[model samples]
Target: MADILTLETPRLRLRTWCDEDLAVLAAISADPEVMRHFPAPLDRDEAAAMLRRIRDHFAAHGFGLWALERKDEGQLIGFTGLGWTGFDAHFTPAVEIGWRLARDQWGQGFAREAALAALAAGFERLGFAEIASFTALSNRRSQRVMQAIGMHRDPADDFDHPKLAEGHPLRRHLLYRLRLDEWRERCP
Candidate 1:
């Protein structure tokens, strides 16, 4: 088997996805509460397709969103890691940090913990100069995580997500950013 990149936090494991993770990931993706910030809950087929895309991204980029597993329970909670922004925007062609955890897994600091690990890898291992994250204006939860991880938001950087339709409630997004120097100062 090819070696998989895995990041360890105090209570979670961020690792590559496997066939066995599909069901759990599908469940998480289907949860309305878990996917509230997204366009909609994903069906099983969509979840499978997303998993394929994640695997493909890893193949192409050497890194992508890692399947988040709780260390204590050995369960797939969701995912957290880095990915390239796909849509055209001022921030196009940037590396972005993102995360999604099972609703039950919230409020435990897992998102922040995994994000820090991902950011560390992005800077120290992947050598990214900076990383960005964005979410719908209504997604305060994710915004909080962004802030907690040392990412700063500039209002002028906020823009409507091109993929989302105009007038869609979620089209308006807030952008957060962190450069290598900032992360080093915040973490070191």
Candidate 2:
């Protein structure tokens, strides 16, 4: 296995995924409420496949969605970190920051805290010039987190997700971006 990279915040630990995390991750993926913004809730087999892809992403790029663990409870909540955007768009071939926490963990600011740490790693450690994040038009919660982390959205950057069918309700997405210089201005 590649050396697992871990990022820490006040209340959460974002670390590489592990064998033990599969069950909880599967559970999180299966939650209809948690998967509401996604195409559909993943079944166990599909969730396992997702985990494999996450692992492969780390192997290929050195960073992927980290397993989110609550420090106080020491339990897997979900995942948050950076990944490459695979679709063709204006923002194609960009690093994307993202997160998904268990429903019970929402409204507690865990996602924001963890995401800030991930952004720091992307900017400070990985030396990325810019990081992008996008969500369906209806995913206000994720959009809020993107804004909270100092990402800016340009209405002109909005585009339909190529992975989704042309007429799908979730096809329309809003892109948010933060450049290294912008991150320095906001964080430093």
Candidate 3:
């Protein structure tokens, strides 16, 4: 088998998706608590489709939402990485850093650990000028992860996600950003 693209952090490994990850990802996707910030939980087929998309993105762009693995136990947790926003918005054409972990993995600092590794790749290796992340106004946990990685939210940049219908509870979102210069300053 060809070697998978992988990035390592102190406590986690962010690697390209594999066929084996679908079942665990499906479980994570179907968990209501895990999907709370999203519109709804995904069924098996939807989860599989998402995995296909992630795989395709990596094939096309050389990077996408990598499957996150805990280094200690070598278990699949979820995913974290950078992806093209792929929608028309004020931020269209942007690359966003994002993550999702199994509910049981919450509060373990894994998301932050993986996210910082993703940011390093996006900024230092990929040569991106900036990366952005956004979530439902109510997804404070994800927002906290964004902040922990040195992303700053600009309320004026908040937006209604076009994919969500008007007045959808998860439509309104808060935008956070981290520029290469900012990340460099924060890290160096």
Report, for every candidate in turn, its global Cα lDDT versus the true structure. Answer: 0.92, 0.91, 0.91
Put down candidate 1 lDDT per residue, 1-188, tens digits, no spaces.
12348989898899999999999989999999998989999999999999999999999888899999989989899999999998999987999999988899899999999999999889988888999999999999999999999999999999999999989989999999999999889778
**Model 1 poorest ten-residue lDDT run:** 1-10
Distance from true location, Cα of 39 in model 1, Å: 1.1
For candidate 3, give the lDDT of residue 180.
Answer: 95
Question: Residue 33 error for model 3, in Å?
Answer: 0.4
User: What is the clash tally of candidate 2?
Assistant: 0
Model 3 Cα lDDT, one tens digit per residue, 18-131: 788999999999999999999999999999999999988888888899999988899999999888997899877899988889999999899999999889888888888999
lDDT of 2 by residue, 1-188 (tens): 23338988889889888888889999988999999999999998998999999999998988889999989989999999999988789778899999988898899999999999999999988889999999999999999999999999999999999999989999999999999999999888
State, as a TM-score between 0 and 1, how close model 3 is to the true structure: 0.97
* Candidate 2 pairs with clashing backbones: none
